[model samples]
Target chain A: MKADLVKTLQKKKKQILEIWMEKQLADAGLRDDLISNEELRIQSEELVQALVQSITEKNLGNVESSEFEPVYEILAGISLSRAKQGFSPRETGIYIFSLKDSLLQVIQEEMRDDPAAMYAETIRISKLVDSFGIATFETFIKGREEVIYRQTNEITEISTPVIRVWDGILALPIIGTLDSSRTQVVMENLLQEIVETGSSIAILDISGVPAVDSLVAQHLIKTVSATRLMGAECIISGIRPEIAQTVVHLGIDLSNITTKASLASALRHAFSQLHLEVRKKQKQQ
Target chain B: MEKIPILRMGHFLLVTIQVDLYDRLAVNLEADLVQMVNKTGARGVLIDISAVSIVDSFMGRIIGNIANMSKILDAETVVVGMQPAVAITLVELGLPLQGVFTALNVERGMELLRNRIDLDLNPEDDDDDAISDAD
Candidate 1:
């Protein structure tokens, strides 16, 4: 009886692809901009062929069997590519469910003469397609996470910048929340620049930081300590009024760290520390 | 017996740690450094650890102890040429080595030691000159 169901699906593979494509094309949420109809037809045909070839009599009830490996592989590939191409989860879900609908319709028509046989085959096919839908969602989420991880690394690279503001002064403008990992990057960059430029003073500008909590304050202190260890003075500048209030409210002791209200003041302090005087040249008379 | 050498120039003592310091080596260096400071009556001590890598918590404490011991013996300690990784590790280990002065390199460390000694001796020297003139 199961063999008969597999045979029916195998025979009507072309018909299933046709119905699946029609259903997808008719849907309002179909992303025609992202995927062309011709390419969609090729992907759908590949999935349909793989599914029918894998659905043998013995493994029809077991979607997890090795016989269905090819089908799952093809589904995973399609789902991952769609995710990278910016397909919505809803659209991917509908794509898998629509294929299930097409398969069940074909089975229903072939077993019309025997209602009991049709009911049994329908349950088996539904269960199999549901499992495939789950696999698709899993791969889709994995692909999206890869995209997010890459973007996070890029942001970490670009955000922490160490600028040599003067011959003996390096300025690092931190533009984000201060975390332990970011603190490590910021500290390393500042220390290395200090070594390369022989800078005795470093200015950490935190004006772009949105908020300051105890953890961030701890990171800042750690960075300053590390800089000092490398035989340089670190001055934290661009202290927002709210951050100062929060620090005082939290009772975090920043008395040891030299902080400035703005980068200009930090620069002025650095000059005095280095015994460097930047005077405006006299205008030619 | 492996020993880290302490070189004395004028009123300052320079110790360059060229090997990775183990516990025994660090302890011996600490004892020897303090003894040398007392014996020579040096005004400043500069330690260059640029070649030494891989510092543990014990090493961090040893460095801090050396600075504190020297301070008590009337000598200023300036640690110089600390690698970035070592500095980060020391900070993370919660040993900032407070009261320890630092410099970028040996040249700067030497300059710092000279400047600190000069600052401390300037007022006393003026009094000595006035007394000599009166005599």
Candidate 2:
């Protein structure tokens, strides 16, 4: 078994194999020594990445995205998450990031007349595509947002139901459990929309949120911080009791931020802060 | 509209609506669905449109309405089986459910409904009577 393993290692890297030979002669345990070598470690990582790249590049156009499951995990764990998914303004931008090109390509290819099924698929892959990639994230989010924008051709930039309100308030009623990438998109869109709208308050109501994990909690914090940089407030609403527990257990401190039990309550707070009250029709719905 | 009983267990009523074209039904689907949901009397509902070829702004609005109506009636609504173009269309249109439960697939939608609505034999609230179409 040892000889076979070494033989396999030799095929991958002769230089590492030479180093392994020296370490083997000096050490009593070959398994630990071989694995702990810096050269072999680098070689293994390179080989793994190369293997994945070859698989992805070769089969990207031919196979369905589901066929690239192993690649997605590797991408998420490897270069994409480790080096690319960095925090800070430098990484944020106006772009659509999508790693699953196979799915996106299919959607774009069929968008003309076969739009109904295409829209359906967009929702399907929107769930699968990693929310981190600028291209993928943009495609995923814009795909969902497109329908809303296109609904009324006469809709002004400011009239969309979900948008940044005046007085630095961004009323975004979160509809689903957040993952890291979607969190990024939300952060990006909110910040950009704030810059454009000059809003001071961002009320995020997650009452619709069904589950909350540590990552989700972290994403929320990051969103809050990002909003703050744009000189705006991010008010969270619809925080369920269970979500509150998850936030606390995960050691997320949200004390300084404004939170409400529901969107109605948050909007009331927003109006009160703005010192404005509605007559009836505008506030009725 | 092919109705597949994905989840018929207890309080969970999972159904996949095969909309080869959700667009074809977008015009009246929203109101029709609200009525169908009320008629079904299911505490939890999932609409699977995996076979749908596209999703538009009107389609997205219908989804949003379904979610809101579901909540008003104390029922949970989940939109499932969306494809890639549908995702782009939704984001572009910006009409997805603001507070709706959505899943990648039908099975996940079932799991989500199961998690939200406690399936018990004891019907404490007359949830069925709450479905209101009053405009």
Candidate 3:
């Protein structure tokens, strides 16, 4: 009975592909934008070929068997690629489930004379294809997670920028919540820039920082002290009223470090330390 | 036998740590530095530790102790040329050496000492000296 099922699937492979394509095309979730119809046909044909080659009488019902490795591999690749190509989960799920419908239709037609054997074979194929659907969804979500991880790394790299505002001064504007890992990045970048530019002063503008807690305050103090240990003065500017209140309410001591209300004041303080003055030029009459 | 030398320059004493400091050697050096500062009546102490690499909590406390002792003897302590790694280690060990000053290199350290000594000698003359230096 099991051998007949595999044999029947191999014999009606072409008919199964045709029926599968029709079923997918008729489905409301079918996405023609992410993949063309011809590409979809090719992907389905390759998956079906692998599925037939891997199927055997003994392991037809055992989806976990190594004999189904090729089928799972092909399905994972197709699902992940579709995910990368921006296919929705519903579209990818429909693509896998449609195969079951096509296979069952062909099996029913091939075993019209053996009703009992056909019913048992349909259940086996249903379990195997359901397992394949679960694997596809797992791989598709994994691909999406990889894309999100890369974007997060890119954001950290872009967000922490050390700008050399003056010859002897560097300014860094932080624009998000402060965390320990982010503070490490901020400290390393600022220190590296200080060494390269030979700057005497560094102005850390925190106007873009949204909130301040004790932990964030500690990170800032660590950054300032690290800069000072490197023989360069660090001036933290952009003390918003609320953040100041939070710092005081939390009883975080910033007395030993210099802070300014705005970047302009920080710059003025840096200029005085560097013995620099910015005089306005007379406008032409 | 391995004694970290404390050399005297003018009214300032210089101690350059040229080797990794073991616990006993660090303790001995602390005693030697304090005694030398008192004997020389030095106004400033410059400790160059650019060559010393590894620092644990014990060494950190020794450095802090040396700074505190020098302060009691009326001498300012300026730790100079600390490698970035050592500074990070010391900070992680929670030893900021709060009362000590630091500079990038020996040259800058000497300059800092000179300015600090001048400020100590005549605080009222600092403004006149600064305006003249600016001109």
Model 3: residues with Cα > 4 Å off, grouped in runs: A111-116, A282-285, B122-135
Report the Cα lDDT for residue B38, model 2: 71
Ranking by DockQ: 1, 3, 2
lDDT of 1 at A32: 94
Residue-wise C-alpha lDDT for candidate 3, range B26-61, written one tens digit per residue: 999999999999888999999999898798999989
Task: Highest DockQ: give the candidate number.
Answer: 1
User: Of the candidates numbered 2 and 3, which has the greater lDDT value?
Assistant: 3
What's candidate 1's DockQ score? 0.82
TM-score of each: 0.92, 0.29, 0.91
Q: Please provide, for model 1 over B1-135, each residue's C-alpha lDDT reduced to its tens digit, 9 standing for 90 to 100.
A: 899999998688999999999999999999999999999999899999999779999999999999999999999999999999999999999999999999899998888887787777878765874686699
| Fraction of native Cα contacts reproduced by each candidate | 0.92, 0.00, 0.38
Q: Each candidate's root-mean-square deviation in Å?
A: 3.6, 26.0, 3.3
Q: What DockQ results do all the predictions give, each relative to the true complex?
A: 0.82, 0.01, 0.53
TM-score between model 3 and native? 0.91
Off by over 4 Å in 1: A25-36, A80-86, B122-135
Off by over 4 Å in 2: A1-285, B1-9, B22-24, B119-135
The prediction achieving the highest lDDT against the true structure is 1
Model 2 chain A poorest ten-residue lDDT run: A87-96
